[model samples]
Target: MRRLVLTSLLLAIVVIGLGAYTRLTHAGLGCPDWPTCYGLIDVPETSIQIAAAEQAFPERHVEPAKAWNEMIHRYFAGSLGLLIAVIAFVSIKLRFSKSSKVRYPIFLPLCILGIVTFQAALGMWTVTLKLMPIVVMGHLLGGFTTLCLLFLLYLRINARRINTQGEKLAESQLKKYSSYALIGITILTAQIALGGWTSSNYAAMSCVELPICQGDWLSDLSFEQSFDLIPPNQESYEFGHLAHNERVTIHVSHRFGAIITGAFLAWLAITIFLKAKTPSIKNTATILLSLLVIQISLGVSNIWFSLPLKVAVAHNLVAAGLMLSLIALTYKLRQNSEESLYE
Candidate 1:
């Protein structure tokens, strides 16, 4: 079960990265259909096939490259979903078995199954609704949530092994710092949502110049339409339908959010490093700090390099890393607290 959870966790990262790549390449609507690309099991490759696909969906021409990108993401996501289902089944089996000595979490796997089902729905809506910002953002959040949950499950299943291997910390120290770690996770999650909203609305490139947006961004900033849950109806939100001002507002907000999130997480990391009684805890803090630095660098590189594809994808991946690192810290702190209670 541990091995399965780890596999699922890694695959979740791949699915997220592929999803980012697909969106960045403007391939969200490449299929123009749910689950299938151009009404076929795979992308229409042959000239005849492409012609048929284009004929059926006259509004959407066949772009083999983009269609393949979308399909590849779907394939991986489908596999991950299946793997989660298996994990849930195995968990249940283990829970009911008379010979089993270890207790496994049945509820978490079942909850993951539910989330994956909803994620599938969001995936369909992302295409059917023509890349609606809310749906896209929801899908992005769903992916992140799924990944975090799997990481949590992994930590739970390995609690004994982890606790035995690590140098113990005083319960008082960890309990005092756990709240800070929790706050750091909360801040990071909100920043990631801001990122998702910015990307979904095609605002990532709205602010070309760093430090701030274009000339007079403050005067032009308007939240009226930028954060609307229900945007006006449109045939397609392919590139983006929002005005330049709205996009600028989103981009600038994300920039500011990054600054705030970075500052808070930096403080938490430093505090943990200084207060940690064990090398394991100290190393976790060091890793968290390093990820923050890398994530910030990637954010800057996105602007400096004009949002290069690789840099943008790396940014998303690093964000996931940051999330997992914080989660690990929180889990370790709580685990130590529990152990201290028994001791």
Candidate 2:
């Protein structure tokens, strides 16, 4: 079960990476259909198949390369889903087995199973909704949520093993750090959501200048349209709507969010390093600081380079990595707290 949980986490990371790749390559609508590529099991190969696909979905031409990118991502996601299901089933089975420890509840798996199912629906809507910004952002959030849940499960399983080995930190100290970690995670989550909104709305390059938007402290901004979820069918959102001001609003807001998130995390890391006695706590804080620097650098690179594909994808990857590092910190602190209570 532990191995399955670990495998699921790795697969979740892969799914996130592939999703980023597909989005960056503008292949979200590669298939123009859900769960299938060109109305076939795979990308259209022969000339006849390509012609048939074009005939069937005239609006969506067959781009074998992009279609393959989308299909491969879907395949990996489906595999991850199946693996999660198996983890859930095996977890439940173990609870009833003769050597059952019953230390872990079946509810966590059940919850993750449900989340994965909903994530699949979000994935379909991302394509079927004509790349609606709202749906695309939702899909991105769903993927990250899945990764976080799987990471938590992995931590819980390991916590049990660690407790059995009688390794524990001071409960008072662990609790203090755990609280700060929780606060940091909450801020980072909001930051990531803002990032999703910015990317889905194609607003990353809205303000090409750095440290400011449109070379001014104030500009024409429309919060309503910027955050608007509904789009008219008449408007071709292929490159996104012509709401130039709204895109700037999103871009500016994300920048402000980055400042707040970065400040909070910096404070948290320093506090941990200066006050914590445990080597694990100190080491995690060091890693957290390193990731924070890298993430900010990537964000800057995205702007300086005008949202280059590789840089944008790397930005997404680093954001996910930062979240996981914080999660690990929280998990470690919680583990110490649990063991402290047992002792």
| Highest TM-score against the true fold, candidate | 1
Model 2, residue 46: distance off in Å is 2.0
Across residues 1-343, which tens digit of lDDT does each residue of candidate 2 receive? Answer: 8899999999999899899999888888889898888778899979999999999998887899999999999999999999999988997788678886455657888889999999999999888787888888888989998999898888777766666766554446557678888999999999999998888888888999877876653756778778877866632355677488888899899999999999999888888788878777788889989989999999999899888888888888888888988998877776644543211
Off by over 4 Å in 2: 234-236, 336-343
240-323: candidate 1 lDDT, tens digit per residue: 999999999999999999999999999988988898877777888899999999999999999989999999999999999999
Number of clashing pairs per prediction, in order: 0, 0
The residue-level lDDT of candidate 1 at 296 comes to 98
TM-score of each: 0.97, 0.94
The lDDT, on a scale of 0 to 1, for candidate 1 is 0.91
lDDT of each: 0.91, 0.84
Alpha carbon lDDT at 43, candidate 2? 92
